[model samples]
Target: MPNSSPPVTTEAAPSEQPVIRWTEAGEERSALWRSERGAPPPKRVVLADDTTTADTAYRQACEGTALLWRGDFHNARQLLQALARRADNVPARKRKKAAQVVPVADAFHQHRLAQSQRARMLGMLLIPFNADYSIPLRRAPDVKTACTEAWGPADAAAGASVASLRELLGITSAHEWRRKGVEIAALGEPPHNRIHPHYGVFSPVRGEYIQLVATAHLPKPPPGQTSLMAFDVGTGTGVLSAVLARRGVRQIVATDQDPRALACARENLAQLGVADQVQVVQADLFPEGQASLVVCNPPWLPARPSSPIERAVYDEGGRMLQGFLKGLTAHLAPKGEGWLILSNLAEHLGLRSRAELLEAFERNGLRVISRIDAKPQHPKASDASDPLADARSREVTSLWRLAAIQ
Candidate 1:
């Protein structure tokens, strides 16, 4: 983190959380006490060990307290799993709350606080592994299988590992996603119609943007140009590039800053038999030169991310969004169009406004030619229990067809 970087705002900001100091095994130990941010600070900090009962751990977590583990790593994971079970089974009396209406922005803020608190509690259970990802504690189940499954075989050379149980769960979930693969109807047919996302790359489970890219009209090639070419900015898994190639675009170039995303895109393009048509390049936002069409799907949230995985969802200060908008004209060919995929959730939450978005277009020498809209079909959209449901239910994703101002 640099001096200019914004302060960490999430519950996982270890620097902002409480600190714990205690004598462990006759040695003094000090560590940051992980607790949910935006909520009341933990009223209790107990040094929990392998001998701590799961019931006690669950009780403490439910009481808005924290447990700093100084025990075997494997037991910590089991304790976390137990805590999750207990958290899921909320008591009826405690579960009931009056449904009071809150302003959209306030509701969104509260929703984030609840989420941060939940993650903080879950993150308390930690895991420690040796250089080879081998557990050092006795009676620990062999995690080599799970580790290898999540991280590739190359991870065997990992020098040392210290991560939260929540993070481990993420890796495990990634392995399942990699195996099952997200189905993209716009990509083509059954068995071969999916993008296998790498561990850190953003998954393309939201199909609305892909559909927009697939069905939207493509700008005609310049009069003298021999064939069609398009650019896919921030291509995560090359799904958008593949969609363009499959739709008969002669050539496509996809750019991304992350090496993991570049590799994932390359593999997917090759698997889809469009490797020759789509070139994957490593670049911050845009590649060199220009094309007939440009597509960008930036992170929706304009906030600081707590971890690497969250980077795909959070666009700090709307850097990517504003960057793509401002740079679209320079890289687009004559009469070219830029397809911007964005969600209105930010507007609903009062983080950004429609007037601001439109002003960005005007200031960037771009004007909306047309817009195609779609509602999200993900499970979260229909989750009534979600504190942000009001905004989610009304949120609409749009593919804004933009052209350089005359």
Candidate 2:
């Protein structure tokens, strides 16, 4: 057996860091705790193995007891799947009886609550990682690369650490996604068209918005200007920047507040051969200088995010939307058009209103020049069983072309 002790670090004293404790082989054992979701160390933990019954595991997990799997790694995954089935298996009769037509906002809230609870319960199935990011269990495949990509290099001095199997699986999935890359039609055919998203950066899974950006007309430069320059606000994976580069934009400044996104954008842009044309910078919303064209696609939902990745999806109190709008006038060069890519699903969910959006634009001294709309083709839109299907089916992603008030 290889040494699984965590690598020591000067960042925090051992006594100050979180640890997970369990009893095994008639002795007490513990390891450094890790959770990307920020879940605290489990208050109670017990060793589980191949013989652990799914029923018992589910019941214990529901009771807030963590299961430290000592069984075959494959069996642990199977147990996780079993836990999910049990969690989702509301009897048909019970579901029918409990079903009530809720207000769209209520339905969205309820759905979010259920999702949070399910994640918490499933996260109770913990996996131990050796100092090198390998699982010390039978049938455990090497996860060193995936773990390193997501969590950075293993701390040899910190000894071993423990994290939920759910998150480990997510890390592996993200690794595959980063390796394979997502194809963007806007950038043209495969091979050169893919945007490899770094772990934690939002992938360009929704192509409709990208298509709108790809097809929308670029703002013309002023008479004195010889070339076109564009600002891509909150650039994730640099897909929009790449699209603009493909469309022959002379120069593009891509800005993001997230370090991961900045790195991801730069890598993807380089991969797509747009590195020379795009400049990736870290900024709150906009870079220092103004551009003839400023483009932003903020998180459509105006709600608090539960995790790091959710930051790309939910914008609490519409902070990003408001920030962009309020700063638009200062950042727009002469006759520059600000491209605001938005989704009206927020409106449909009653989280925001069309009139409110218009009001913000007007207050910011910006007026909508024109709007290009595209219906989502994602499978969730057509799924009748989705809790928020009504709102999703009616969703329309739009590229709102805005100009400063003369």
Candidate 3:
């Protein structure tokens, strides 16, 4: 097995105190014990091996402790899994059952309750970091850049703490994504072929919207006229813009407000060789000029985002959707079309209605030209045991092609 021991460093010993040293499985570790007035002596101990479960470590941590592992790195991973399973097995408060029956609303509430409990349980795992973004323990690699990307670069002598095993996993996944980009096949053939998505930018996991944009019928240009221009609002990873550019659009404007998303989009567009064709700008939705085509694939759910990553999944107050519907007409060229790709999961959840959506478009001076629908093919669609399987089975993603009411 390869050595996974993290790089180590020595610190200055505390004055006026004797540092206590101990040996565990051939490895030496040291810590300073201090007595404050009538306080008990600090319980300084170390882990026997990497097989130590996080739950055990967590219990020790609550008692003011630390762990020094001696086993293989892979065994530590198994221990973490065991800790996770234990955490998940913990039961939550039972809900009151109605005398008559459970309604659809009750089912939704129950689902949300279970989700909240799961989040709370998984959030107990805490990870520590040093001022310079280093984990101060054995076998810990330098995570400076990863921490910087997620939490910004640390100030001089400043350190922060983060909890939640879910978030830690997210950061770890983000690090891997930053190192190895997500592959995007939305971009078509020839000049524009590939898009490498960065960490913060939303990955193109749902292929339905991209397929709609790629296969949609485009209008022909008149004689002596150049190719049409299209705008990809919220061009996360610049995937949509690259797809448009590959679809024979003469010029493309990709707009986004998030700095991270903008940077991610720029890199992806550049790598896909569509940077010249697609001009990425930091705008909330539309730029100054009008385009023959406009595309938007906003968050499908009308729910609150608990964290930054959830922003890609939840749209608060439907701001992005409303903004696109309201400002789209002013930025669309004559005879232009606006493609709105959205999922109807919110409808099944009783959050929004189809009538309300149609009314919103009518009030915004836009009318639906046509719609293309696709059924979700994700594994969750077939997972009958999933809590949201009932809703997922009825979910459908639609590409609502719209045009300004003449």
Best-matching candidate per lDDT: 2
Estimate the Cα RMSD of every predicted model relative to the unseen true structure: 7.2, 3.9, 9.0
TM-score of 1: 0.81
> lDDT tens digits, residues 337-399, model 1?
999999999998888999999999999999999999999999999899876777899999999
Clashing pairs in 3: 6-139, 47-68
RMSD after Cα superposition, model 2: 3.9
Best by TM-score: 2
lDDT of each: 0.76, 0.90, 0.68
| lDDT score of residue 319 within candidate 1 | 97
Q: How do the residues 1-406 of candidate 2 rate in per-residue lDDT, one tens digit apiece?
A: 1112221221222675678877666566778888776677888777788888889889988988888888799999999999999999988985884487767787788788889989999998999999999999998999999999898888899899899999999999999999999989999987889998888999999999999999998888877988898999999889999999999997999999999899999999988888999999999999988899999999999988888899999999999999999998899999999999999999999899999999999999999999999999999999998988889999999999999999
Any idea what lDDT model 1 has? Answer: 0.76
lDDT string, candidate 3, 1-406, tens digits = 1122222332324554333343434675454322111122223444435545566655653444433344553454455566557645534444234223465556766777767554544443334455566665566556678667766667654333322334545666777776676554556553345455555667777777787788888755534567888889988878888788777787888999888889988887778777899888999888988888889999887777655556778898898999999999998888888999999888887778999899999999999889999998878878997767788999999999999999
**Which regions in candidate 2 have their CA more than 4 angstroms from the true location?**
1-17, 91-94
